[model samples]
Target: MAKHSFEFKKKVVLEYLNGEGGTPYLSTKYGLGSNSQLRKWINAYKEFGDAGLMHSRKKECYSFDYKLHVVELYLTSEVSYQELAIQEGINNPALICNWVNRFQVAGLDALRSHKKGRRKTLDKTNSKDATQLTKDFTIDTSMEHVRELEDELLKLRIENAFLKELRRLRLEDEAKTRDLLGSSTVSEDNSN
Candidate 1:
């Protein structure tokens, strides 16, 4: 895909923003490919304004914390990779999807950067054995990962239950102590 200049994107977006034309109309007038690219540029402009409209060739590196947050959002929410990237001001949606895919393939640890070189993958192209590995090995590994997650979830649930029970006991004990002190004061007044 051809990268549009910052000036070009900014002009087109501003024209649309200023009610000169809609994306389709602007796209046609400017000889751009389609309204979709214009829509993305408009969204980026809306999210980050002028700076968002600027085009840069330099690669961006997201922090580990930010990557984790985006990955968690993908895991727990119904938002698609593209929509989440737009909301989070990420220039490329595919990069976010890559993060999620890496997480799924190797868990959170996979999101970390590794040495730049070829890596081993499990898939083999042999026709006869393909289906067997596809169904058995992939499913087995995925299920094992799921079980590990379930175990962690169970531990967290147990800890939460323990904390809640401890809180309830403390509240009950406080109420009992308050009652005893109230009764003693009443008895002293009665005796006097």
Candidate 2:
């Protein structure tokens, strides 16, 4: 469905035409996404009159040959995308521009529509034998377990070092406190 109604678009374009506001102002006032949309509406209204501002729902899919022809016309002539779009009865000018760009970059093969969506994704999980799946899962799980154990071991080592440093610092603090107080409270543990 079109975002803006034909009546709303016509009203906006007419408002612009009647010198009410520019594209930005009218677009903002009416919350019509962007000024480009308003400009498109205005241009459509001017070029094709009322029919241009109307919401065109039926998307016409051109053949590969027709697309190639359009691209050829675009390259060989000095026509703008919008003009060529109108000539070719295409709804959007960007489609022509896309075709031209693809043709320029990758030549004719790019114009042909490739299969849409992720090519059925090779159903690897379903296609594999149960034993194969189990083996893969077991290996992955074991590796994950190994990584987790390594992480935990590293954490424990860090904690142990921190505790040792803390104990040393506390003993030093106790020594300083005892020396300041002139008390010989020997806190040294002889057990290694």
Candidate 3:
């Protein structure tokens, strides 16, 4: 269902109450998707006034027994969901429908409240074992990190030595070339 603002619900409810239009006309005029939805709003307005039209901030957590009771009543009797909701003091009739659906699909376990958030994977049977495992893991990771650092340091040293040797060879070659050129010029001068 599309969630309308409190102001919009009030406006629609007021329009209906003030004889401006009926459910079909008001729903069509305001582009309400379901005409039944407008009737629900009108019913809510009559039953609870403005408070029923407003969205509930607090969520109501129903017990498993209560849910089962509601489901059983809905199944066994000829009561409608809307009537059951009012009888059970629930604001939203859709919640009763949801409960009945869940009960049908997944059995009683589905109606039970589940723990919020993820399940814990670690076993907490022995504190000593947990502490031992944590210590061992830390030691293993530290040793591994030290080994990686040593390997990187060795590679860097080798690279530095190789580059140093290459630079020395290049300097030697340049010096030899300069000396050879100087000798050639001297020899040419002597011949002349």
Q: Against the unseen true structure, what C-alpha lDDT does each candidate score? A: 0.80, 0.77, 0.83
lDDT of 1: 0.80
List runs of model 2 lying over 4 Å from the truth: 113-192
Of the two candidates 1 and 3, the one with more favorable lDDT, higher being better, is 3
Q: Which tens-of-lDDT digit does each residue in 1-192 have in candidate 3?
A: 437988899999898889998889999999997789999888777787887788898889999778877887787567899888777878899999999898667666677798999887875659888899899999999998996686456445545665676788899999999999999999999999
* Model 1 lDDT tens row, 1-192: 447788888999999999999889999999987898898788878887877777656888887668878877766567887689887879777799899888667665666665797887867578767888678998899998996797457445545665676788899999999999999999999999
TM-score of 1: 0.54
Identify the candidate with maximal lDDT. 3
How would the candidate models be sorted by TM-score, starting from the highest? 3, 1, 2
Reference-based lDDT, residue 159, model 3: 50
What candidate 3 gets wrong by more than 4 Å, as runs, is: 121-192
User: Could you estimate the TM-score for every candidate?
Assistant: 0.54, 0.51, 0.59
Worst lDDT run of 10 residues, candidate 2, spans 183-192
lDDT of 2 by residue, 18-79 (tens): 99999889989999778988887777777788888776767667888788778767765678
* lDDT accuracy of residue 67 in candidate 3: 87
